[model samples]
Target: MRMYYPYVNAYRQNTPNDHNGSNQVMTVLGNGSVSVQPDVANVELGVITENVSLLEAQQANATTMNQVIEALLRFGVPRENIQTTSYTVNPRYDFVDGEQIFKGYQVSNMITVEITAIDQIGSILDAAVESGANQVNSIQFTVQNSDTYEQQALQEALANAYDKANAIATSMQVNLNPIPFRIEERTDTMPIPFSKLALSAEAGATPIEPGQIVIRATLEVKFRY
Candidate 1:
């Protein structure tokens, strides 16, 4: 008896039956991907303030961040959608003549805002910046309902695996089982971040383009022939 095992891209492996008597098994890997427009966006923006005194720096950062949040709320963003992601105060230092000199305290406050209306990302970013937001960190795009797309991708992957296995069996003149004895799914869904954006708070109505998001699924199937 003989067995055939196929890896990625339909690479075949042949083995003579020595162990397991006359049992013959075939293994193959399949991959599928689906791309769709993102439905949601998360924007990370904040304010940074520096002052000689730590208390002053903290107070300034708090005031600016409050203004930014209020602006976002007035622009139709729900209060619950805005959440603080990071808040830190660190001492600033400078090297003068091979000596470390204390400069001031730097306070940074960052918030993540979730926007369901994808078209309004540019306007919202403009609003935040106009209201004392100085630091624009990043933006991430994702789909709200990912389970549906994942299932579709999985189905496509299984179909692909079946096709490959059938082709191998036909070429080798052997009987192939239509049903796989084992199926393993490897799926990964992640939010795509748009980091190459040219951002300028001073520029009017910053242009933001949200690209398509891709969901991928991989499967390893084993069949008896």
Candidate 2:
């Protein structure tokens, strides 16, 4: 019991033992958020499919896919981040008189690139186009990074909490101990998961935009006499 008292001392009226000299010490959490709707930027990088033969088709698709990756690398995109999101090597089926016939294997490899630089998006797309990446995917605006903004939001939440505590304490005619008796923060902000984040990679330049991203944080502080 005696040891736990120190935790609350910081908020109590200042005394010789409590260095916090009653400076309206009330525990509060403020909330803040920074957002910027990024300009549209994107380029779809994919392989073209042509069935010369089942094996030849696969080989050709792989070669073309590698060219696209090379183009991205040339544009300063990290090779590791460029991933093959889709791959398929299947025979094309044509039904004649309800009879299915295997024409040839349609092999294709499609990669998804996480473009970090907004400005380079257009250029990257252009490069993909020049590198024989003809199939354009979906594109749109979204947030690439949210950790910094999330921290900002947390600060704002703390401020809000402090204001609330002060108003309540003042209304009760209490000095609010000028500090927080108990400070608690609980937030479930999923930091930019791959699943939750995305920009359309549809065909035709995939006009993409990393629009404004919203980040929120909440804080709870309890003040005691």
Candidate 3:
């Protein structure tokens, strides 16, 4: 993250009347935002296997997860970008006539795949499901270089603050300093979620829309006249 320092002008000369001890300061709040399409997609997909025997369920889940990873690799995703997010083995049970009946063992293996190519998300989902991925957990779209956009937003916020302060000074018939003595930045970023995902292989090629992400910046500025 890049930090922005308070702006001070070297050419401005202060007189005795412009003493720092004077409480003649104007405070203003400014906001700025930028919207852009996300450059990266994170998809959480995995396999869930169930069997009467615990060993069989584990083996089945492992085999399916391996195949899914291989398919992702062949589809242009880097090996390092694919990571196992969770793996668990649990016993399945059912309530029959108020009696707990032991069903089987269920094994689930989930992995998160980072895709830099945003346009290939649909095809990637199809490939994963075809290769044995049965569960599609979530999909999130976000910017890869968020710092750059945040910096731009900060600059815009500062500009907005200066404009508001100058307008206020003009209305009060007082000279306003172009430079702000203090500035505080507050940034907020929210990732876009693609929640409507289908994991069935019969659904054919899935259509994915990354949409747009918004980067917002708020600044509190204090200026002296």
Candidate 4:
């Protein structure tokens, strides 16, 4: 009895055109993932203020934001790591009996802060809130750079493809030919899920845990036999 190549038939339609279109071409998918502790954390903090006048609202928001930035700086955060991400001023309105009424103006100022000192994350969050940060939009943990991890994943994926191709060829009693072409289906470093925190002085230091970040890559390999 001869072994039938079921895997080859499964992916026969997607075989590379440069190779033989018949049962000679086999396509296989290989995946690789690498996980490591996160090195940096990004936090988005915002200050919202409302007043009867637009100038007053904006001024109040700006003052609070300045205090927050100053606190972060005093905590050893670099100036370049602290940046204002967004600022907006909008009018507040109320609808009563199908009529629009102007209530007051609202100002929103948001900033993104990058922390390289992982151990200081909790302290930094506490300081920001104590200084006047009202809204904590999100906190994300990720690696500062992923080039090294990306290369490692690519190498692992390619090695996996090679081993799989050989194993299938031996099992089917066919001679595996050179690889004609391969495609990198996907490669990315994904950040951990972020959580929103309510900022208050009474809450004390915000506890932050930076977990591991996962880097993954997938490849489509075509082998001709």
Number of the top-ranking candidate, with TM-score as the measure: 3
Ranking of all candidate structures by their lDDT, best first: 3, 1, 4, 2
Tens-digit lDDT track of model 1 for 1-225:
112325332323453343224368898887788887998999998999999999999998999899999989988889999999999889999999999999999999999999988998899898888888988889999999998998788778878888998899999988776657677788877678877445566899988888888888888898778
Per-prediction TM-score: 0.87, 0.59, 0.88, 0.84
lDDT of 2: 0.60
Q: For candidate 4, report its TM-score.
A: 0.84
To one decimal, what is the Cα RMSD in angstroms of model 1 from the true structure? 6.5
lDDT of 2 by residue, 1-225 (tens): 011223434334553433345444455554555554543333335776768487777777777777878888888888766777787777788899999987767776777777767877766776676676766565544555555666677667656766787787778776554455555655433322222223233434534344455566666565543
- Order candidates by TM-score, high to low: 3, 1, 4, 2
lDDT of 3 by residue, 1-225 (tens): 334557745225553455456668899987888897899988898899999999999998988899999999998999999999999999999999999999999999989999998888888889899999988989988998898898788778878888898899899988776667777778988788766466678887788888899998998888888
- What TM-score does structure 1 among the candidates reach? 0.87
What is the Å distance of residue 46 in model 2 from its true position? 2.8
**Worst lDDT 10-window in candidate 2:** 190-199
Candidates 2 and 3 compared by lDDT, better number: 3
Per-residue error (Å), model 1, residue 76: 1.9
Top-lDDT structure, candidate number:
3
Off by more than 4 A, model 2: 1-30, 36-44, 48-52, 94-103, 134-148, 168-208, 220-225
lDDT of 4 by residue, 69-126 (tens): 9999999999999888998888999999999999999999999999999999989989
- TM-score of candidate 3 relative to the true fold: 0.88
Worst 10 residues of 1 by lDDT: 1-10
